[model samples]
Target: MMRCGSVIKVKPGMLDEYVKLHSSVWPDVLKMIKECNIKNYSIYYKDGYLFSYFEYVGIDYEGDMKRMADDPTTQKWWDVTKPCHIPLETRKKGEWWAEMEEVFHLD
Candidate 1:
């Protein structure tokens, strides 16, 4: 499995709504995440940033990500949560969250 991590800034005054929305994520979105071979997904908040980590078991990582992006449920979920995010200026094109480089790992 390949581990992935990303970070994004949460819009001021929107953390509570963001957290509340994630507290009970939509079932369809969760199912789509698993269908795309993403596991152990978690999102954490710190300061003004949100960090996410997940393991991808699929061989075709890009394809799986595209699949996830194409899902209607996932799109709907994004619609609700995207407003709460303030994507970093440094993030690459088409990235809502800036992908992080893993410098160390044990296990």
Candidate 2:
């Protein structure tokens, strides 16, 4: 399995709504995530910053990500959630969440 982490900022005053939306994530979107070989996904927020972590079990990470991006339900889910996000200006092209490098891991 491969571990991944990313971060993004939430628009001002949008934290409550964003948290509410995630409290009960759409079923289809969850299914798509699992189908893409992602596991142990979690999101945390602090000072407007949203941090995400997950494990990728698939052999083809890029392909799995592409498949997830192509899903209609996933696209619709993003439509609802994206407005609440303020992506980091420093993020690389085609990146909405700024990917973070792992500096240390105990497991």
Candidate 3:
């Protein structure tokens, strides 16, 4: 399994809405996530930033991500949630959340 972490800023006045939306993510979206081999996904908030973590168990991470992005339900979910995010200026091209480097890990 590969662990991933990412970060993005929540737009001002949008954190609550973002949290509420995530409180009950769409079933189809969740199913797609699982089908794409993403597990233990979690998002956390602190100050104005949102941190995300997940484990990828699939062999082809890029292909799985592409599959997830191509899903209609996931597209709709992104439509609803994208407005609440302020993507980091430092994020790579085509990245909505800035990928983080893992400096330490145990077990």
Candidate 4:
């Protein structure tokens, strides 16, 4: 299994809306995530930033990710989430939420 983290800036004053939207994420979207071998998924918010962490337990990480993105339900889910996030200006090539580096870990 592999763990990944991503960070994004939440639009200035839309934190409430973002939280509300997530509190009731679509059923199909959740189903697709599990189907793609994503587990222990969670999102955290602080100040104006949002952090997401998840584990990839599949044989092919890229393939499972592609499968998730190709799903209609997941696509629709992104449509709603995209507007709520403000991508960093320094985002790297082909990156959506800039990948975060793990500075400290103990386990």
Candidate 5:
């Protein structure tokens, strides 16, 4: 399995709305995420930043991500959620959330 982490800035005054939206994520979107082999997904907020962590059990990460992106339900979900996030200025091109590097891990 592969572990992933990412970071994004929550728009000013939008943290509550963003948290509310995620409190009840769409069922189909959740299903798609599971189908893509993502597990133990979690999001955390601190100060103005949102951090995400998940494990990918699939053999093909890129392909699975593409599949998730192609899902209609996931796309619709993103339509609502994406606007709440502020993309990092240093994020690589084509990236919405800035991918984080894991410097150390235990267990």
Candidate 6:
């Protein structure tokens, strides 16, 4: 499995709402994530920033990501949550969340 992490800022005044929304994530969106071979998906927030971590078990990264991205449930989910995010300006072009480099891992 490959581990990935990403960070995005919660728009001011939207942080609490974002957290609440995540507390009851959509079932279809969760199903899509699992169907795409993603596991251990988790999101955390602190100091107005949100961080996400997940494991990719799919061998075909490109295809799996494309499939997930194209899922209608996911698209609809993003439509609601996207406005609550503030992508770091320094993120690479076309990236919403700035991916974090893994410096260490155990197990």
Q: Which has the greatest lDDT?
A: 3
The regions of model 6 sitting more than 4 angstroms off are none
**What CA RMSD would you report for each candidate?**
0.6, 0.5, 0.5, 1.1, 0.6, 0.9
For model 1, the superposed segments whose C-alpha errors exceed 4 Å read none
Question: After best superposition, candidate 6 residue 17: deviation in angstroms?
Answer: 0.9
lDDT of each: 0.96, 0.97, 0.98, 0.90, 0.95, 0.92
Task: Give the per-residue lDDT digits (tens) of candidate 2, residues 1-107.
Answer: 99999999999999999999999999999999999999999999998899999999999999999999999999999999999999999999999999999999995
Candidate 4, residues 1-107, lDDT tens digits: the string is 88889999999878989999999999999999998999999999988999999988989988988898889888889999888899988889877798888788776
Pairs in steric clash, model 1: none
Candidate 5 per-residue C-alpha lDDT over 1-107 given as tens digits, one digit per residue, 9 for 90 to 100:
89999999999999999999988999999999999999999999999999999999999999999999999889999999988999999999989989999999999
Q: How many residue pairs clash in each candidate?
A: 0, 0, 0, 0, 0, 0
Question: Model 3, 16-96: lDDT tens per residue?
Answer: 999999999999999999999999999999999999999999999999999999999999999999999999999999999
Which has the better TM-score: candidate 2, or candidate 4?
A: 2
lDDT of 5 at 71: 92
Deviation from native of the Cα of residue 89 in model 1, angstroms? 0.4
Better of 4 and 5 by lDDT: 5
lDDT of 2 at 41: 98
How many clashes show up in model 5?
0
Among all windows of 10 consecutive residues in model 3, the one with the lowest summed lDDT is 15-24
Question: Residue 58 in model 3: shift from native, Å?
Answer: 0.7
Query: Once model 1 is optimally superposed onto the true structure by TM-score, how far is the C-alpha of residue 61 displaced, in angstroms?
Result: 0.7
Candidate 2 deviant stretches above 4 angstroms: none
What is candidate 4's local distance difference test score? Answer: 0.90
